[model samples]
Target: MGRKEDQDKVQSVLELLKKQAPLTLKQEKFCNKACVERFLKAKGDSVKKAAKQLRNCLSWRDSIGTDNLIADEFSAELAEGIAYVAGHDDELRPVMIFRIKQDYQKNNSQKLFTRLLVFTLEVAIQTMAKNVDQFVLLLDASFFRSASAFMNMLLSTLKIISDYYPGRVHKAFIIDPPSMFSYLWKGMKPFIEYSQLVLVVSSLDFEESFEFNDYTSYPRVTSLRFDPSSIPSTKLGPCSSSRFSFTVSHSCDSVKPWYLSLTDTSASKVGPTNSSQISLGPVISPLNARSQSFASPIDRGLRRNDNFIRKGFFPSTPMPQKTQSLDPSMIHHPRTPKPSFLQSPALFFRKDYQVSRVEKSRDSFQSFLKFYRRPYDEMIYRSKMKPPLGGLISIVSPQLKRRHMSISQRF
Candidate 1:
C-alpha cells in the first residue's frame, strides 16, 4: 500500500476505535498515531481488525494497571541483570538484553515475570530514539540449561508482545545458544510472526553486527531516562581491580581505540609527563589502592589462610598424630561372638511365632486391595452420612433451627 493510503487506513481505525469506546486520559496518551499505525500494520491494514486489537490492548493495559507500574517494584529482577534496556544497536534501536542463565526456575513467578517483562519493554520504549518504534532483543543463552522449565513463561511473554505490542520487535538475536537451544527455537517459531527477523549467532557475531560495546556490563537504571539532559556527563569505564575501580574522563566522547593511541597516557596519566617511556605508576589512584587492598584474596593472588584450606585439597587432609607403641598386654580380648540366627532362632523371633505362607500371601493381597480402594470407600461413606439436622431445618425453615443451633455452629 502507498504511504498516503496507509495513513488514511490508520486514521479510519483510530476513528472506529473512538466510536466503539471513548479512550480515557491515559489511553489517549498511549494511543498515538504511531501506536495506531503499528496496530494497523499488524492487522494487515484492516480497519476493523486493527480497531478491535487496539480496544483489546487498551483493556489489557487497564486490567494490569500498567500506568501505575514502577521500576522500583522490580528492583530485584533488574538488579540480577536478567532483563534490562542497555545500549542501542547499529540501527539506533534501543537493545534489551535477556540473560537466560540468570533466570532461576525456582524463583519464577508468572505474575512477577509478566510485570518484569512489561516494565523492561516500557523502559526500552522510553529510551528509543526518535522515529524508532521497535527495539532489538538479545537473548544471551550461554550456560542456560532449564529451557523446558522456562518455556511457559517465554511463550506467554511472546504472546503478549505479538498480540498487544505488535511490530515492536525489530529483531531478536540468540547469542551463544547451547546445543539444546535448537529445540527451543523450534517451539518458539510458531509464536513469532516475523521469523526472518530472528537470528542465531555466536557472541562474536552479535558484537560485530550489533556494535554493542558494553555487553558485559550491567545496565544503569539512570539510562532509562527519556531526556538525554538528565544523563550523567561521564560514562563509567571498565573495572580493573574492583567494580568501583574505573577511570573517569571529563569529555563525554567515546573512548579512543588502544591501537590508535600511540601512548597509554590519555587513559592513565592525569597530565603530560616528561618521560617518553610508558609509565604505570600514575594509573593507581588512592581509591584504587584501597579497593585493591580490600579485594578478595583469591582475586589479588594472595595465599589463603592455612586454616582455611579448600576441601579435597592435599593440605586439608588430617595427619596422623604420634603415639606410643601398643603392647600385647594392654590390648583386651575380643568379646565372645553372639549366637547365630540359625543356632538360636528363639532369641530373634517370639516363642509363639508361626510362619504360614498362605496367610502371609493373603494378608499382602488384602493390604494391596485396601490401599487402592481407600478413596472409593471414603467417598461411599461420605455419601451415606446424613446431613446435619440444623442445616436441614434451616433449609426448610430458619426459625425452627434458630432455637436448636447457634448461627456460628450452623454455618
Candidate 2:
C-alpha cells in the first residue's frame, strides 16, 4: 500500500526481481508491494542492488527450506525458549530475545547452536504479519563467559540477516554484553549498521532507550493496539512491571554464582574452613573480640586498635577480665605501654586501613591508586622509612614539623 507516486518505482524493482530471480509460484505468492519496497530501501532504491538482495533471499530460502521451519517439530528444544517470537514493540514490530547460556549446546559445538539459532529466527520471521516486515531482537549475552565461544556464530547470524534478510530487523537491543565484548565489538561493529543496533550496557540504559508509554502517547499511524497480555514474561529484562522499564530487578536464585563453575577442576573445595592448608591466623590467645564495625578513626577510637591487634602488636580486645588478670608490675611496663601510636598519622595510610573505609570511598581510593601507582608507591615507601625523615624534619623545621610529621606518617 504505497503512495500513488511510488507505483512506478515499485514496479521497476519488481521487473528487476522478475528478470533476475524469475519467481516460482511460491516466490510469486510471497512477493508483495511492502516486501518489495523494503528491498528497494535496503539497497538504497537501486534496482540492481535490490534485485541482487532479492535473489540472495530466494537462494537462501531454497537452501534453508525456511517454509518448512515449523515450531511444533522443535517444541521439545524450543521449550527451553532459547529464542521466541514474543510481544511487539510500540510499532507492532515483533520482539525476540536470544539467551546464550540457556541455549548453549551441551556438546559445546557451534554447529548445533547455529542450527537452533537459525531455526528460531526463521520461525520469528514467519510471525511477521502483513506490512510488518521487521522484528526487534534482544540479545542476552550476560551469561556468556567469553565472546570467543560465540563471536563467529554471532557474525554469521548477522551476515545472514543483513545479506539474505535485508531490512528484516527494525531495531536490535543487545543486553548485558560480557566484559570481552568491548574488545570484540571493535571489529564486529563496522559490519553492523549503527542506526539499527543498540548495545545496552545495563538495565538503566535499556529503559532509557525504549519504553512502553512512548509509543502509546504518540498519535497512531495505523489501527494497531498493543496488547499487554500478548507479551511473554521475560526474566532477562526489567519490563516486568507496568513501568515498561528494562531494569534487571530479578535474578534466578536457584542458579549458583557463575564463577563457581570456573573453579578448580577438583570440585571438593566448598567450605568455611581453610581446607587448602592456608593459614589465616597466628592464633594469639583471644584477649578480646574486636568489633568489625568500622567508621572514621575519630568516631571509632577504641575500634581503631584492631589495626594493632591484626599485627599481634596489641591484645585483641581489652576485656575487663584480661585487663584485671595482668600482673600489677607488667601493667605499667614501658614495653607494654598502651598503643598510643594507634592515634598516630601512620595508621591512616595503611593499605588495610584505607581499604576498610566506607564502600564508596574505598572504591574511589582504589581507582585512584590504579592511575597514580608510581607516585603512590614512592610516597608509601618513603612513609614506611622511619627515623631519618620523620625525626630530621621534626628538628629542622619545628614550625612545619607537625604538618611534615602527619604527611610523612600517613604516607
Candidate 3:
C-alpha cells in the first residue's frame, strides 16, 4: 500500500485494539493483548503460564543480595523458574531480567540500569560457593539500550569493591550492535581506577575501544573487536597502552564486524537511572546464532564465571566456524585452558601488515624492489651468496676454470 493506506491501516489496528481494551478505574491506562503480553511475557500457548509467572515476579522484590535462590529468599513459597525453560539451569532467564525494556508503541524500552541489573546479580553472585577469582561477568548484546546503564552498574559496583574488597571483583562488557547503541560507554571511563582490570568487547569487526582516547598508561584493560573490518577512529581514538588487544568472533556469513576500544581514565559522573539507548544493529537470527559465541547471559552473570569473560585475553580458538550451531556446553561450561590469539595465524598474519607501518616505511621500497628488478639477484640471494671482500674479483681455481672454459667453448 501507499503512504496514506499504510497510515490508515495503522490507525485502524490501534482503534481495533483500543476497542478491546480492559480499561482501569483511572482513565489514563488502558489494557489489552499488548499490556498482557508485556506483563506475562507470553508467546504462543504460554499465555496462561506467563500469567502465573508474572504473578511470581511481581510478588517477589525483597533484598537482592548474595543468596543463590535470591528469588526464593524473597518468598519461601513454591519453586522452579529458569530451569522450566532452558532445562538444566539455563542462565538466560535472570540475564533477561537485567534487560532494558524494549519500546514499541506497546514496549517500555532500553536504558542500561547497571545497579538495576546488579541488584539482581549481587544475589546470584553471593549465593554461589565459587572462589571470587573464578568469577567472570559476561554481558550479551542488549538491543536498543545504552551501555551507560551497564557502565554505571559496573563502576559503582567496582567503587564498592575498591572501598571494601579492593581488587576482588573483575568485570567485562560485550557490545553487539544493531542490538545495542555505541554511545552507551560515556561515563565508563573510570572503571580501570577501581578494579584491577576491565575488558571491552564488541560485535563489530575492527579493533574496539577498551578505553577512550585519553589515557595511554594504565594497565589491566583489554579492548577488542568482533569482526574483520576496521573499526572507526572515533570509537577507539587511543589506548591506555600498546598491550591493548582485539578479538573477532563472527562467522563467514556475518557481514557485521566486531570492535573494541580501551581507556585508562576514571568514570565519575552519575549517568542515569534509566539509560534507554536507541541505536541498534541487525538482529541475530537463529540461523546465525551459532556464529556468535556469547554465553547464556544469566549463567555468565550468576552461574559460570569462567574463561569467556576473563581478566586476560578473549579466547582465540575463534568463535566456532559454524555460526548457528553453538554447543550448549560451550555456553555453560567454562574452558579450562582458555585459548590465546598471540599464537593464532589470523592475528599473526594481520599484525605482519598494518596500515601505519606500510605507509611509514615507503622509503625502503627501492631496496625491496631491487630484489625483483634483477633476475640474477634471486639466484644470488637464494644461494646466500656474498660479494667478494674489498670488491676483489673472485673466481674458480685455474684447474676448475679450465674445465668450465672447455664446457663453455663447446656450448
TM-score of every model versus the real structure: 0.48, 0.48, 0.23
For each predicted model, how many residue pairs clash, with residues at least 3 apart or on different chains? 0, 1, 47
lDDT per residue, candidate 3, 59-176, as tens digits? Answer: 3322322222222222211121211111001222111111222231123212223223433344333333432321234333344354444454445545543432322233333434
What are the C-alpha RMSDs, in order, of all predicted structures? 30.5, 31.4, 39.9
User: What would the per-residue lDDT of candidate 2 be over residues 1-411, giving only the tens digit for each residue?
Assistant: 557656777787778878664788988766677777788887787777876777777886777665554444444445555555554555666566676583455545655555566665655555556767787766767767777655655666677777766778765655566678768777667767533354433443333332233343323422266665778986554232221223443554635422211122223222223434324332111221223254334333332245643234355885565534556776664565576647768667778744553343333323222121111122222222233222343235435534346666888
Candidate 2: segments with Cα more than 4 A from true spot? 1-5, 102-115, 125-131, 194-196, 204-411
Deviation in Å, model 1, residue 42 alpha carbon = 0.9
The weakest ten consecutive residues by lDDT in model 1 span 370-379
Which runs in model 1 stand beyond 4 Å of their true positions?
Answer: 1-3, 101-105, 187-191, 204-411
List per-prediction Cα lDDT, in the order shown: 0.60, 0.54, 0.32
lDDT of 1: 0.60
